[model samples]
Target: MTHLLYGDRLHLRPCQIDDLDFLHKLWNDPDIRRFLFDDRIISREEAQSFVDLSIKSFKSGYGLWLFFERQSDLVAGFAGLLDFSQEAPSLIFGTNPLLWGRDYATEAASVVLRYAFDTLKRDRVIADVDEPNAASIRVLEKLGMSPARRTIVNERPLLYYEIRDRVGN
Candidate 1:
């Protein structure tokens, strides 16, 4: 399991089978659902299947990690890298509503971006945010990612943002 630290407010760890309930609850939230996964309501079985798939994928160094609030030790949400294409890998993040506006997403994403660039030694990281998700756009900007392209995914228009690690200062 990989553990990522982000100051004293939040940390990220691997998502375990025990986290299924939390994932179900979070995914059921209308607001949260609207911004992700095509605003669709998912069944428990679907959630389980997703977790199972992610667990398998994690073995290959690509999958989501559970976000946690350090003080409360609660699952805040999830963040990780996704294989968007063989040539371009993207970073993705989702935080519990209770932690929204708290910078948890930004903090965790910053750590993930650093890991992608430093540990994974990736040259760049990209993100596809729904056009209506202004807050996420702000977070991307704050992470130093700029708009790279815009495309439609699953019938939804998405803005693609990217950040590249410069070789030398």
Candidate 2:
């Protein structure tokens, strides 16, 4: 069983203690945070704690991982299955704004979706997107996820989407 996923243009590895600074910068970037966390900036200490949890999640054999460009080895995005003991795993993804429209997010997400359904044997995976995030909503749709409902989360309207194992096995 491969722990890390490799794609034509990118690779993924579990977050490490060394990744604290990267996550810190990622979560705080104005362009990234605006959509990822509603522009709320996190302190370095909070970033440290997040990395610690990521490490713990990695130790569990599954969790969030960082995406890196294969050639430059630069962190391009973050994605993975967020179990959270939910009925099914939650799909999460974020990519650098500078690299937008290159299909990196979709490709990385395809890899994670395969891992979740085929490798992890998950029956389904779900994603919750803010209604205004048309780009993300399109990504999920391109991944074959169907919008299931509309609801409010954190006082923001969201659209829920889900995709089942293609074979339904």
Candidate 3:
């Protein structure tokens, strides 16, 4: 697997074809899907398609990753930059419900944010969190991102957070 970024407790790597099973398990978790799109359970075929599409997107330097625990190498969840547009992008991240409340999301997101600004040289990055998802809001704030705007996604109100590259100071 291709390692994208690593933190003290987690390492983010590209999702491999063999990761379908793990991805399926993560996506199907009830709590994991709670803040996501309607708690939809995706089929194996859908999971495969998602992985394939993500792989294709990775080639262009935009896609999600299979977040792994650095100590045990257990698949925790997915995290990375999602391409919202050529000029605008969003930070994508989530963890298995079992791993919730452990700060893994914050750790992984912090590393990716550094990669976005320092490595990719992106001017800014944004994240849309469901208004009621307190955990997600905390993660964004922990990474130095501040509320930028509010918008509706899929008929649900969402809060957008943003962080920009700080080249000096």
- Best candidate (score: lDDT): 2
Q: Please give the RMSD to the true structure for each candidate, in Å.
A: 2.1, 1.7, 2.1
Candidate 1 lDDT:
0.81
Lowest lDDT 10-residue stretch of candidate 3: 80-89
User: Which predicted model would earn the best TM-score?
Assistant: 2
**Order of models, best lDDT first:** 2, 3, 1
The deviation in Å at residue 82 for candidate 3 is: 1.4
TM-score of 3: 0.90
lDDT of each: 0.81, 0.84, 0.83
lDDT of 2 at 25: 91
lDDT tens digits by residue: candidate 1, 1-169: 4544464577777677888998988988997889777899999999898778677767766567887888888888888887867766788888888778888888888888877776667888788899999988999999999998898888888998989987621
Model 3 regions lying over 4 Å from their true place: 1-3
Model 1 per-residue lDDT at 154? 87
Instruction: Please report how far candidate 1 places residue 58 from its true position, in Å.
Output: 2.5
Write the number of the candidate with greater TM-score, choosing between 1 and 3. Answer: 3
